[model samples]
Target: MKPLHRLLALALAVSMPGGVALAADLRVMTSGGFTAAYQRLGPQFAAASDNTLSTVLGPSMGKAPQAIPNRLQRGEPADVVIMVGYALDELIRQGKVAADSRVELADSRIGLVVRAGEPKPDISTTAALKKTLLAARSVAYSDSASGVYVERQLFEKLGIQAQLAPRGTMIERIPVASVVAKGDYQVGLQQVAELLPVPGVTFAGKLPEDVQSVTRFAAGIPTGAQHPAEARQLLDYLASPQVQGTVQATGLDSVPR
Candidate 1:
C-alpha cells in the first residue's frame, strides 16, 4: 500500500457511512500480534466515527479461558474479532462469524528477543539459527500461531527437535519476551510486534526467510453482532492504506495489495 492510495482509503472511509446513523458501541475481541497496532489505530477510528469500542484481549486459538474461540463459546458478546486468519476461518466454518467479513490486516513474522544488554545471537541465517537454538540454555515461544509453527514445524525442519525439546518452553497467556526480560529464558521467539513493545529486550532480527513463520493477522465481524455497521466501518479504517505506516512501525507488514 502506498501513501496516495492510503489517503484515498482514508477519504473513502470518511465519505462513506455504512448505515449507522449515530455513534455505536462495538464489542471487540482481539488477540496478540495485531494488538499493538490496533491500540494505536483504534482511537483514530473512534475519532472518525464517534463509535465506542469495548475491547477484550485474548489469543486466537488456545484452551485458555481468554482465548477468542473459548470466549465466544462461553457466550461472550462480540461485534468483531481481530486475530489469526486461520482461526477466524475456523469461526466462519462453525458459523460463528460472518464469512464475508474476513479481511487480512497484516502479516507478522517471528523474531528473536534477548534481555536488554544481552549478547544478541546470530539468527540471520538458517544454519546460524539452528546453532543458536542448540546453544541456548532456555528458549521461550508463545502458545499462539507463531509458536505453534516453531514448535511443530521449524524445529523439525532444523532437525533439532529432540535436542531443543527440553530447552524450549511454550509460554502461555503472556508475551514470550517477558520471560526473557526476567532472565527466565535465554532466548524468546515470537511475532516481531509482540516482542518489540516489551521492555528489557533487544530484538535480534527476524528468522531467515526460508525458516520464518508468517502469521496473517485478520479481522472479521462475528455472528449476532450488535453493531454490524460500525464493525465493518472499523475494519475499513484498520486496513486502510493510511495506517500502513503505523502498521510497519509496529513491526507488522501490511497485507498484500
Candidate 2:
C-alpha cells in the first residue's frame, strides 16, 4: 500500500460513524504473531466503521486445527486472514484467497524468552546463543515461521543441530513463552511480538543477525469471504498511519514504506 493511499483510507475511516456504513460483522483469522495488535485495534475499527469483528487466533502454518490455513480449508467462516506473506501467497495460488486483496501489514523477528526469574541466558552473539542452547535442559521453539527457521537453519548454522536435537522440542499451536514460563522448557524461541504477551516470561532479546529470520505478515480477504468490502475497510484501517504506532507497540515493525 502506498502512503497516499493509506492516508486516503485513514481519511475515509475518520469520516465514517461506527456501525453506520458497515453493519455486518467480519470474521478474521490471524496468526499468533499479529494477534495482539488485532485485539487492540479491532475495537477501534469497529467503532469507526460500525463493523464488528469476530477474530479467531491461530498459526500461519502447521497441522494444528487452529492454524489459519487449516481452518480455511475446513470451511471456517473467515472474512480476512492476517498471516505470513508467503503463506497468503500460497493461498492465492490455491484459489482460496484474493491475490489482489493482499495487503502487507508488518514484519516481525525471532526472539528468545525464559521463565520469569530464571537467569537470562546470554545470546549477544552467535557463539553465546550456541552455548546457551547447548546448556538448556529443554529448549522449545514455535511450530510456525520462527520455529521452522530455528529447527531447520539456526541450529545447523551454529553447527550444533545434531547435539541439540535430544533436548530441543517444536512447540505446536501454543505460545513457546507460555510453556517456558510453566517450566516445560528452560528456553523458548518465537517471534518477538508473539512472546511479549505471554505472562511469566522475560524477553531475552532477538537472535543475532547471523541467525535471525524476519517474517512479513500480510492480510487478504478469503475468496469466500462473507464480507469482502468490510474486510478491505478493516485492512486499510490497520495499515493506516494512525495504526502503525499500535502495531509497533505490539512488537511488530509496520510494513516498510
Candidate 3:
C-alpha cells in the first residue's frame, strides 16, 4: 500500500478501538539504527492505540557495558526490545525474551561516512576500501554489530587488520557517524540507517556487496513484560505493511513477513 493509504488505514484502525485499553503504557528498548522509524511511527501508534511509549537507546553489542543485554541483565524494565536478531535470540535462549514473540523488522547494511563537504573516499571494492582504511588518519566504527564486523572480520577479509588496528576507533554504545560528523574521527563506519540521521556527515556508500554485512533487526517481547499483549500489539503495528515505507525512509529495508 502507498504511504498515504497506510496512514489512513492506521488512523482508522486506531480510531476503532478493540483489544487492550489505550491507558496502558509500554516501555521499549531499541538500537540506534531503527530509532528513526520508531520516532516517526511511534507517535502514530500512540495516537491510535491511546498508549504511550517510553524508549531506551543502546547498542546491540560490544563492551560498552550498556548494551541491550547488559541493560536487561541489570533488570531494566522493558516490554519490547528491537535490536539485532542474534542479540534478541541470545536473550530468548537465556529466557529473558519470548522466543515465539520474535518478529523480524528490517535489514541494515554497513556504510561509510565522512565529515560533510570533505572529499568522499573510494570504497567501491574490497581493495579500495582496504586502502582507504589503511590510509585514514582516524577511523571510527560502532561498538555494535557493524563495528564487530569491521573489527573482527572486514579487516581480516581485506588482509589489513594489523595496519588498521592502531588507529581504528571503536565508538562504544554511541553512534559512530555522529563522532565523524563532529570531526572527532576522519571516517566512520556503521549501519547505513544509523549514518543517515546524523548531521554533518556525507554517506560514502555501503561496503561492496561481497563484504557487506546486512544485519537483520528484530523485535521481541520480554518475558517479564508488564504488558505482553499490548507489547505484541505494538510489535504488530511496527511490522505492519503500511509502515514499510517509513522503514525504508529511515535507511532500512523492511523484511517481508
RMSD of each: 3.1, 3.9, 2.8
Per-residue lDDT tens digits for candidate 3, residues 84-196, read: 99988999999999999999989999999999999999999988898888889999998888988999999889888888889898888878888998899999999999999
Give one digit per residue, the lDDT tens place, for model 2 in 1-257: 54644454466555456723546799999998888998988887776555688888899999999998999989999999999989999999999999899999999989999999998889999999999999889889989999998999999999998998898999999899989999989999999999999899988898998889989999999999988878888888788787899899999998888
Every model's TM-score: 0.93, 0.92, 0.92
Model 2 bad stretches (over 4 Å): 1-20
Stronger candidate by TM-score (1 vs 2): 1
Q: Pick the candidate with the highest TM-score.
A: 1
Q: Score each candidate by Cα lDDT.
A: 0.90, 0.88, 0.87
Clash count per candidate: 0, 2, 0
Q: Write the per-residue lDDT of candidate 1 for residues 12-108, one digit (tens) a residue.
A: 4565567334678889999999999999988777765667889999998988899999999999999999999999999999999999999899999
Best of the candidates, lDDT: 1
TM-score of 1: 0.93
